[model samples]
Structures are given as C-alpha cells and as structure tokens.
Target: MPEAVAVDPVCVAGVDGCKAGWVAVFRWVGSNRASEVQIFPHFADLLASEHEPRKIAVDMPIGLPQRIGSNGRGPEKAVRPLLGMRQSTVFSIPARAAIYCEDYREACSAALAHSTPPKKVSKQAFHIFPKIREIDQLMTPELETRVYEVHPEVAFWRLNGQEPIAIPKKVKGSSYPAGLDARRDLLVQFGFVANFLDQKPPKGAARDDLMDAAVNAVIAERLLNGDAEPFPTDFGRDERGLRMAIWA
Candidate 1:
C-alpha cells in the first residue's frame, strides 16, 4: 500500500460496490464534470488513494446495530416509505453479529437472535455483508464525519423533488433501458453532463453502478455544501459511535 498523499479538499466521491470491487466517481465541488471513475478491489484502498475526497457518499450501509427493530435501522425505516415503488431497492440490514457471520445459515440464525420478531437475513442483504463488514472494520467515529451512508434511490427521490421515481433501474436481474434513461435525465437536471453520463463505465462495473455512483457524488456535493439532510432527522449511533443515518 502507498502512503496517502495530500488530500483534495474540494473533491468529493460517490461510490458503489461492484462485481470487481468498489467503483468510485470523483468530482470537484461546484463542477459538473466527473474527474475520474475508477475501481478499487478493497474499500481501504479508496481511503488511501491520492484522490481521496473530502466527503464520500457511498451506496452501502455504514452503521450496524447490536440489535435491530422492525425495519432494520432508523434510517431504513424513515426512508422506505418515501421511496414508494423504489423502496424495494433498500434492504433492511440486520445486526452487526449477523453481518459478521461467514455462512448464510449462520447469518440468518444470528439475525433471528438479534432482531425483534426474529427476522431472517434476506439473501440480497446477506450477499453484501462482506462489503458492509469491510466498511465497518475500517470505520471510526472521526471517519464517519467524512464518509456517509447514502442510498441511490433515496438520493434520486430527493433529487426528483421528493417524489419517488416510478421506474426500476433493473427488472428480473437485467438492466432496463428506460429506467436507466430516466435516472440519466435526473442526473442531467442536477448538472451532470449527458456525455459523461453516457460514457462506458470502467471495467468491472455496470452502467447502473456508474450512474448510482454519480448520483451519490451529487449527494456528496450536497452534503459538503450543507444542502443534504439525513433520513432520520435525529440519527442513531452504533456501539462504536458510527452514525446510523442515510444522507441524501
């Protein structure tokens, strides 16, 4: 690993997990252009990279609870209804113990023990547990000030004048062109160039992944400017003091 170089105070990033690793889109604050789109095999590398942004809005869960309530966490509960049809994009995260488990059955068992009403971990949420753990292991209270948990659908809802987007980005595990186009249009309305939005995503990330990352970057800028708000007006913190709110 290389030493982290001088930070770009004006830069902010939007990141999402991808098949290869984490795909990040870096943009300068107040600029419409995305400076770069790249992938890191590990989350830690992005933190150590030369382009380390002042704020990062990533499409992943940041805070983990010791025990969960009805809707997973406060943030998920607050934002789910706001998404309407797109709410399915948000998954209810289980407890930290469940997330740390190595096997699906073990995770479900742990989740049942940790959550109220004894819910099992969903396969979709379980699939991303490793990525969640990756961020959890490296995250600290101070780091929480810079890295924020964001959901792309939630961000889009906020961007779309607080109305839920009617289109699903994917259907039956396949990309939907109309849905992608709708999101792209929203991105353009928010100052992203259509040219950059249409460019091929870097190897290992899908087009929707890139677009999700781009919207996250937009929210990062909003957060930097004090223009963004958390899902739960009053947020929660885990045992380690990591913030448990999703910003948009």
Candidate 2:
C-alpha cells in the first residue's frame, strides 16, 4: 500500500460493515458537508488507504467476554429496553473464543465450552463472525483508544433527543423502505450537511449501513466533545483489555 495520506485533524468518522466490506462516513468539525462516504473491502485497508480521522465510531461490538449474564453485558442489556420495538437490531456478541470457530456447529460447541451457562450461537452472529474477528484481531492499544463500539439505534435515539424513532429501519411493505429519509432528516437537524444524506448510497451499501455510519460519525464528534454518554458506565475489558462500553 502507498503511504497513507493524513486526514483533517478535526475529522470524525463512522464505519458500518457492509456486504462488500465496510461503509464509512467522515465529517469535519463545524461543517455539514461530509468528507467521505464510501466502502472499503477491509477494515485495515480503509484505515490505511483512506484519510485517517481523529476518532472513528463503528457499529460493531468489541471486547468479547468469556461469560454471559442472564441478559448479556450491561451495555448490551441496557439497549434492548431503550430501543423498545427495534431492539432486535442489536446482536449479542458471543464469547471471544466462539469467534475463532469455523462453522456454526463448532461455534456453538465453543460457546458452550467458554461460558458457564453456555450460550447458543446465533446464525446472524455467526455470519458476522468474520468481521468481528477482523476487528478483534486488528485492535491494539493505540487503535483501541481511537476506535470505539457504538450501536446505530443507540446513536439515533440519542440524536432524536434521547427518543427512539417511531419508524422501523427496515419496513416490510412498499419497496421495503428502510426509512433512510426519516433518519437523514433527523441527522441533518442534528448538524450534518443536508446534501450528504441526499447522496445515493454506493453499490452494496444498504440504506441502514449508511445511516448507521453517519450516526457513528456524529457520536465520534460528541465523544471528543465530552457530550456523549456511555452505556453501563461500570464496564469491564476483554481478555486483551479492550473496553466493553458502548457510547452513544
């Protein structure tokens, strides 16, 4: 790879895993126009070739635990009640060991071995295992300090003045609308440039992916500004010492 060019110092970013790899949104401080909104095939490639933002909020769980509670981690547990009807969007991150398993059967077996009560590995979580493991392996002390875990719904709820949006992101009828416009409107009001949301999503970037990434960028801004809130202020770290808190 060529030498990475430096990005704006005031830039903040959000990343969402996409079918093609990752979709990201970058925004500079004090302006509505986004610096970038695109997809990259690998998380590391995105960071290396793309302009480096000061902080990046990503819609992925970090800090996998060996054991799970009745409801899961405090941050994961806290979100369901807060999201109300839209809670299922959040997938539980399984034990760190389960991520290394190659198949669902192996993953399930591994989950049981690692947890006291044993956890059933979901097909959804299994599908994202590759992406999760990618982040888990790539994270280091220096990178962990800059990148953080965030949930789109949590970030959106926070953006809607601490209220969840009434519309579901993936609507069942009428072209399967993801209510991207509704989210865009709210984000615009929150301070994003109006035109950025108007841009068509690139190929393989689902509407939800774009919206999710955008909110994460906003969270990055609030995080540095000391205005963001973390779930389960009392949190723990992963085996490698990665923080388990979810910021919104």
Clashing pairs in model 1, backbone N/Cα/C closer than 3 A: none
Candidate 2 C-alpha lDDT tens digits along 1-248 = 89997654577789999888999888778555546888989988867745677788988888888777667766788777888877887887678878889889999998878765777788878999999899988897578767888999899999887888878877552323556778888988867776877677889887778888998989999887888777878878877888887898
User: Could you estimate the TM-score for every candidate?
Assistant: 0.94, 0.89
- What candidate 1 gets wrong by more than 4 Å, as runs, is 1-9, 30-34
Best by lDDT: 1
Output the lDDT of residue 29, model 2. 82
lDDT of 1 by residue, 1-248 (tens): 99987753488899999999999988896544456789999999999879768899999999899999876799999999999888888898999999999899999999999999899989999999999999999999989778999999999999999998898999999989899999999999877888887899888999999999999999999999999999898998999989999999
The lDDT of each candidate is 0.91, 0.81
With a 3 Å backbone cut-off (N, CA, C), the pairs that clash in candidate 2 are 32-193
In angstroms, what RMSD does candidate 2 have relative to the true structure? 5.4
